[model samples]
Target: MITRETAGELLARIPVSVPDQPEGESPTAVKASPFTGAERRVMGILTVPKWQQGMDQGVLPRAYQDILDVVRDAPGPVRAKQIAPRIGLPAETSKIEGVRSKLKRLVERGWLDEGTPGLFTPSHAWTANSAKSP
Candidate 1:
């Protein structure tokens, strides 16, 4: 068994190589924006519950608002099974099926965009409105 002193010696014998940077290019740091493309405006996220008032004016049922919120935040198309738990439904087959039905209704009503079969995303209008400053 090697003692601590021998372990130190063994480690000291190892050579470490620094990654080479481009010959003349200095390292540049990228600045991070407060919001990524997928992020809704701070006001919009805060007012999602308030947005529901607008939805109510449009005749959409209140139950659909949560599903729409999940779709709006997704980076890409999402399946109902994936959206189930976000709205607090258990991830069971029945729950997923119920979500699927709601998704179809939303799609039909133009709140969501249809991507690949069984996949749904936020509508362009929804994103545009939510991203507006105000």
Candidate 2:
């Protein structure tokens, strides 16, 4: 009888068909199989790392890094509404709220500081630590 591991291996080896490509695309182009072993492992890994002194900002996912960069460059503490447009997001209420949520996450992770309600700035620990590096 096939065990669960054997069944999973069989399923992962199956090639999935690609949908029609856009115009100018070669029909003979090879498509990668969906849910390959390596891809599955990567997808399961956590994207964020908790802030620690000497830990580079590169550890963050791109979206989180962009938010941190914008806050760090600002003249002073900034609001999510002001940050959204700078980060390529529309300055609408929904988008601002989404940015606000990410900002809050950064605060919780110790990457940023909230000196006043709805205002954010880079954490002193992060700035001081990063500045000490080359």
Error of 1 at 84 (Å): 0.6
Candidate 2 residues 1-134, lDDT tens each? 46767867877897765587667767577466432222213233545555876677787778888999999999999999999999999889999999999999889878999999999999999999989999
Q: Over all chains combined, what TM-score does candidate 2 have?
A: 0.67
lDDT of 1 at 54: 26
TM-scores of all candidate predictions against the true structure: 0.53, 0.67
In the range 1-134, model 1's lDDT, one tens digit per residue, is 45767877876787754355555554453333333232233323322222321233133445577888788778888999999999999999999999999888777655777877898988766666666635
Clashing residue pairs in candidate 2 are none
Model 1: residues >4 Å from true position, as ranges?
1-59
The models' CA-based lDDT, in order, is: 0.67, 0.81
Question: Alpha carbon lDDT of residue 50, candidate 2?
Answer: 58
Count of residue pairs whose backbone atoms collide, per candidate: 0, 0
